[model samples]
Target: MGYLFGPVLSRRLGLSMGVDLLKYKTCNLDCVYCELGRTACLTSCRDRFVPRQKVIREIELRRAEPFDHLTFAGSGEPTLSLDLGEIVSRAKELVNSPVAVITNSTLLSSPSVRKEVSAADVVLPSLDAVSEKAFQSINRPASGLLAADMIEGLKEFRKEYSGEIWLEVMLVKGINDEEAEEIARAAESTEPDRIQLNTVVRTPAEPVEPLSEEEMRRMLEIFPGAELIPDWDWCVPDRIRDRLMELLMARPGTLEEISCHLKIDGSDAIKYCKIMENDGLISRRLHGGKLYFHAIDES
Candidate 1:
């Protein structure tokens, strides 16, 4: 499970099994709001960071696992992996689940890079800024990288690829929030299937600010058809939490079992379970090929 990580409950992609193509924190952009701390190996150069055959072998081994998407994400930008296209193609052959690639939209400027990324069934690309100053302040890109070129690259990508494109816009308060309208216009110009809005929800590398939900709602007017995808509120209701804890205390339950017994949606079950797990209220285990959560006996 070195290259392959969770079938984690992603808000947008559902239960996505992640594929890490690059090394830890190796990215072209040292984004101010990155959750993986700072970029350790910062470069725009694409190379074979991991063994292509090894990644494919791992994918072959895990192809039967239940997941919605075999997502190319985690650690750093997936586009930075030179073997991305071959790996993606191989994964498609080995797995029934749709393939996805999440990128920062910097390397899309290169036609070859765009071609490599287009192999995925779905592409989730981010555009946080349209102005160079905003881009530099938020993304802290490698030298010679321009926001305008990124936008143009996205536009070009739209023209070339027929696959589903869910363009994401990360808006940090005061950093790139001011240019929301411009970013939205550029995003619209790309003609993506969907435009998703996100903000700093995790503990970021830098002390950045996230916009309020009300502000995000206001932005919907600016962006027209864009959808806000941040986990804005991390609260689970007292009743649900109590019931879930009681259920887990009695006996361990897989996500499906918890959802069925509680008469809650599967996604809600995952959200509650994750929050409880983080709070040390419950613990996770894998038994008979299914993930289960049981209450921790703190006595």
Candidate 2:
């Protein structure tokens, strides 16, 4: 699993199989709220950090695994990989699942990068700030990266890419949170299929603060139709949780199987699974071309 990890339960993308293309912590931006800590290599240059064939071979091997998306999201910005386009193309050819790329939106300014990333069925790009001050305070981008250029690049990308674009806005409390209106206007200009709003839920690289759930709710008024992605309360009902754990302890089951057995709707089943997975109570595996969840053996 050097190149591939986790058909993990993602908050947004269900059962996402992650593809890491770059070395650990290799990114152009040192974002304050990044869960992976500081950027070890902060260069804007794109190079073949890992052997391309090895990565492709891993994807080829896992082609039969069930996942909602074959995601190209590395420990750092994925577009920084020189082999992104080719690998994305290869994944699309190799897997039945939709291909996705999660980018920091810094490199989207380059036409070459935009063209390469367009190969993905879905692109989740983040825009935290529109103003230079807020951008610098939040993203801490490389020497030459500009907020204006990032915005323009997203607009350009929207024109060329035919697939779904789910624009993400990572709002940090007292940082870029003030610029929500401006960011929302900019996000709307990109014509993304969905605008997803996220705040600091994971332990951040810096000791930043997350907005209250109420604050996030009010943000819906600002960015109409934008989906909130922050972990609020993060509680799965006790009855459902116990039942899921019991079921998984008996035998592994797919989402569909779990939904049918529990007599819960698909959405509720996924929501519960995601919460349990986050709490490390359960884990997922791909078997027989389907994703199955099982309780983690503490022993």
Candidate 3:
């Protein structure tokens, strides 16, 4: 399961198996609350960062196993992988499971990028801010990316893509939280299938706080088709669950990596892993002072 990670339960998508298309921490935005840590390659350029054939082969292998969805997500943004469309097409050929792409929506302005995601059953893109100041404060995108351009890209993608487009809005307290009206206006202009309201529930790159439930509900009200995803019990397949526990026991991973690999959300992944640790199935360790997990009895 080098490239394939989980069929873990997701709050948004059902049991999902993830495909990592890029190496770790390579992204266009240096979001303030990124759980995966600081962005190493802070650029918006698209390229074939990972070998396409290798990623395809991994997806093919994972498809042989039982899973609900085959998702394109990884340490970095999936759209940054230039051959993403090819990978999606190849994946569809190998499995009947629905294919999805989780992206930051930075590159959706490009016709080719939109076309790439057009084949997927679902495309979840992030729009943390509608204004330039809010964008910088919330997403902290690369130097050249403008909020206007990103919004236009989302608009263009909505017109071209027929799949279920879920607009992800990660709200950070005091920053983008107060701009729900602006975000709602922007989302209305895009006309997406759904608006997933999310907030930071784990350690962030910067010292940011999450919005209150009341604020979240108010924001959701502002956006017509929005839903607030709360942390809860997720359903993972028996075999996949066992394997996930085994993997976590071997090496601790950030919630983002686990979610990307497991095709689940970071918050949900943390909840499940915490339960496992509490039951003594695994133990937590600190490497370089960052928390990780490993199996108590690997034998």
Give per-model TM-scores.
0.88, 0.91, 0.77
State the RMSD for candidate 2.
2.5
**Model 2 per-residue lDDT tens digits across residues 1-299:** 58999877776787789999999999999999999999999999998888999999999998887777899996899999999999999999999989999999989989999999999999999999999999999999999999999999999999999999999999999999999999999999989999999999988999999998999999999999999887684678898898989999999988988999989877667888888887899987767777788999797
lDDT of 2 at 124: 98
Error of 1 at 261 (Å): 5.0
Residue 19, model 3: Cα distance from true site in angstroms: 0.6
For candidate 1, write residues 23-66 as lDDT tens digits: 88899999999999999998998899999999999998888777
- Give the alpha-carbon lDDT of every model: 0.90, 0.91, 0.79
Positional deviation of 196 in candidate 1, in angstroms? 2.2
> At residue 158, what lDDT does model 1 achieve?
93
- Answer with 2 or 3, whichever has the higher lDDT: 2
Pairs that clash in candidate 1: none
CA deviation > 4 Å runs, candidate 3:
232-299
lDDT of 1 at 80: 89
Question: In model 1, which runs have C-alpha deviations exceeding 4 angstroms?
Answer: 238-251, 257-265, 295-299
lDDT of 2: 0.91
